[model samples]
Target chain A: MTQQKRKFGFETRMLHAGHIPDPVTGARAVPIYQTTSYVFEDTDKAAQLFELKQYGNIYTRINNPTNAVFEERIASLENGTGAVATASGMAAQFAVFMTLLEPGDEIVSSSHLYGGTKTQFTHTFKKLGVKAHFVDPTDMQAWERAITPKTRALYGETIGNPRGSVLDIEPLAALAHAHNVPLIVDSTFATPYLCRPLDWGADIVVHSATKFIGGHGSSIAGVLIDSGRFDFSSFPTIAAPDPAYHDLKFYETFGHYGFLMKARTVTVRDTGAALSPFNAFLLIQGLETLSVRMERHVQNAQAIAAFLAQHPKVAWVAYAGLPDNPYHALAQKYTPKGPGAVFTFGIKSDNARQAGKTFIESLHLFSHLANVGDARSLVIHPASTTHQQLSDAELEEAGIDAGMIRLSIGLETTEDLLWDLDQALQLT
Target chain B: MGSGPSLAVDVSMNTILSEADRAKYMDPGKIRAALSSTKTIAIVGLSPKPERPSYFVGTYLQYEGYRIIPVNPRATEILGEKAYPDLLSIPHPVDMVNVFRQPEECVEIAQHAVQIGAKTLWLQLRVVNFEAARIAEEAGLTVIMDRCVKIEHGRYSGSLHWVGMNTEIISARRGQRYF
Candidate 1:
């Protein structure tokens, strides 16, 4: 099949780029190849494929053609050399850590991260003999101080989950580079459409495709994009030959594609985090209109943020898009397009807990769901849902108070969104 | 405290629907009855493969005697039934319309179910629309939310195995098994 040129804008590229007409039947759409094994050319070719002598599908658990197209598309969008698709966003991060770090290695990460990421880093990774050092993402000195000889990477999010604080990516990236480590960013909130962290100096990017990338909330998938900028060769542990895969050195064989090759061959190969072809197909369809849907998402979010800021019943609002927001400058520095469509606000009521619950139950248009980045508006009380596992102090540290409510604006009419918010606030 | 029964009876009587409605709608009795009566179900999103939840759920329900009608616009058939594009397009009046579409699209399916005169509108777990529920209710249909009918059937019909138990006696001979 002739590969189509990647010439279209974000919207068009999303729909067409990195994918071509099926050579066999000329099918216009991506066909889900639901099979366990692929037909090898011959015995020698199968040996070459397994020996990492050539790239070809060996098993569905490691890779699939349908999923490869998705990985390629997202890597192109993020301006990365290559990407590794995973079963879910958490699995994507796990692949990154497992491929990059060994026992006793440390990761310097931001305090303001998604609860799941925090748990994975602080608890799960700890059990694996890796430690996590938490610091404020905006504080470059703190990040530098947190780094030690054992520090393997610096991690933060483009837009912190729930808290919505935009990180200063450039300075942090510089700090990580100076410390001989790469910056791993969770860009799930501010997807490449809003801000490409690779363009700003991030060395690696990960996403919960379960969110924005699967905009319609139909599937759970994730992707890890390698910027091809980080010189992993400086770290002999990762650049050297792997004893598991026939002593093949990733950096020597793949060069710029070393990180992604290692992640795919080792992490995904062993742990089995490969995304299903069906989910990948669903995400590709979602990506087709991502650029268009994101614009309306930002506009709706900004308008709702403004309306909530001025409402009598609102105690506080945290949206980087707002001029008075603490992270507004950082948002401008990193994401000039828009801050994103997710933000948190607090309702002013004596029984804020009950009021928040009541408000969520009262919403007509906005569905109360744990997931975000849907085609329809969604609302959640973090104190009761997402951050419920944390105590009062931990919740406060995570910037989630009892009155805090997180809103993920969708591609709905701004008037309808505000109307729903207004009625819900009145009930509160 | 002494008037609790009478007060409970008064509240139950004044409720929008009676105990029968609760038993029919919220309770698993209606689903049990449906399972006993029907042998076929037309799940609109059933895939051909077994990995998908829709495929597994539909297959499981079919295992319990309900025939699954996989309706897909692209597929010729799924699991032996001729896949129809829509409910109206189906040859027979299906006992239930199991939807796997997003919540926003449920209103149209509810309307279609009403048009096809389906006996039940089973919106799969995590997909619900109050407006659709109201419309179905007005059209004399039963609506259940955030529930899997297969799971309910397993729970209410005593067909599932349970392992957890509380015990007092340490010896095996004296130990009690509460059914």
Candidate 2:
């Protein structure tokens, strides 16, 4: 009936939510909990844990105290009830799907996505008998037309990979909810500092903590955060009795925590894709400086996208932060701080593909790599590598041209980065 | 505040409690008042299983010198204390009624708490029922919802943060013992 502002800002939660000082040693920082299993107080306690009748760590494959802090902090930042940490973003995504989807279940997802995810959905999921329908992320009608009775969820990226199209979160979330399904947003690019998708009505949020969350590029990790607002009492996979756990009905039993509980105890336990406590610890360190890193990441990206937009050697730049870009308004609405640091541009030359290769090789600051969201700048020509096997028509359909050079702008000095870009452009 | 069906909200972590709700339900002052003045807690739905949170909490509270009354239909006694099937069956003075039951089951439990004239009605984490909270409030019983008794005690005693948990209380001052 009444409302009040939440205490603890993003930065505060990032540094402190999941952990407190070590009581024994008086250590201020989180210590790496490297052990595989915990000691049970007695035989009864061990039985209780094995039965899943209580909450305590039975094995590292499911959860660890060190990873618990990482999961909790991520959940707090994303405004979710809880989270499950996984080995990678791909693993996190898989854990969620495995928990929610059945053999015949389907999902309607945005066509523009990280190439690895696309392959996972199209090829890998195909083997699992789960169908994924990809539609233009920006077109509301296209998303609607793709949903079927078997569709269990609507999926999208907060920021489209390489294409620079920001997802229409609010509307897409509404569409998913109206269909009695959840919207899962891959917000790897627009980290919670930039956009909290759960605040926009998404039921679940997944992240590649390997990227921005682990700003130093030191660890590969991922997390799945659940808003706990969706009523899954009617959703079959959640509400129905799970045969694996002695006919335990998750939603009816655990209520708001049903999905995450199932995701952890069953999915991660059986899947064997748990995030090691060591990696979780590194990501925790990365989280401590997330807001600081993201601010600079966004600032440099806005400047770099602008610089390349007007360059004579650049044919086109697709950065939502640019005013003339199609998704600029949506970007302002969803990610007003900036449209994330990763974006794409094309070199203006007759043999643009060759020029793109030369441009990548000429850059001193930007490393040519397949990853994005690193603290260091990265350049990738998807057509020549990630999307190399795709025909020109396939590339065009995916909104990537042969000359498309995706840049993940880092926190380097803006002038130095601009100089690097300038020199590389001249070579192109 | 009146007796009726009060739906427990599944509020996100970012949406903190309302000022009125905080003062009435989550305020440190109110929680302290409930904890310091109370010596006995009637645990409704207190599972006998060792791993169940309610059982562990009851065990901890009993160890802390509070008389824990376990209310489970099937258990004759728990943690060396007598068990009652319902609140009304307890013939002794009950200082607080702590609940680990479902949200929908709370309205009836609140009525029993009011009937038994308990001083406080406390719900465990994720066990919030606003109607029950309102009923207990209307009956002049102190109501604390969606908070764990063990955690609150640990927090106030300055031990919750020992394991890297944010107490949400920043202080150069240490937590003072109340009991």
Using Cα atoms, each model's DockQ against the true complex is 0.01, 0.15
The candidates score, on chain A by TM-score, as follows: 0.96, 0.97
Predictions in order: lDDT: 0.76, 0.82
Off by over 4 Å in 1: A1-8, A388-394, B1-179
lDDT of 2 by residue, B31-148 (tens): 6668878999999999876545576678767755689999999999988888999999999999999998999999999999999989999988778788999999999998988787
Worst 10 residues of 2 chain A by lDDT: A1-10
- 10 residues in a row with least lDDT, candidate 1 chain A: A1-10
For residue A313, model 1's alpha carbon misses the true position, in angstroms, by 0.6
Clashes by residue pair, model 2: A19-B164, A19-B165, A20-B164, A20-B165, B6-B131
Model 1 global lDDT (CA atoms, 0 to 1) = 0.76
The segments of candidate 2 whose C-alpha lies over 4 angstroms from its true place after superposition are: A1-6, A391-394, B1-18, B28-85, B99-117, B123-140, B146-179
Residues A236-341, candidate 1, lDDT per residue (tens digit)? 6568768886666776545556777788878888999888989989988888888888888998998999999999999999999999999999888887888989
Docking class of 1: incorrect
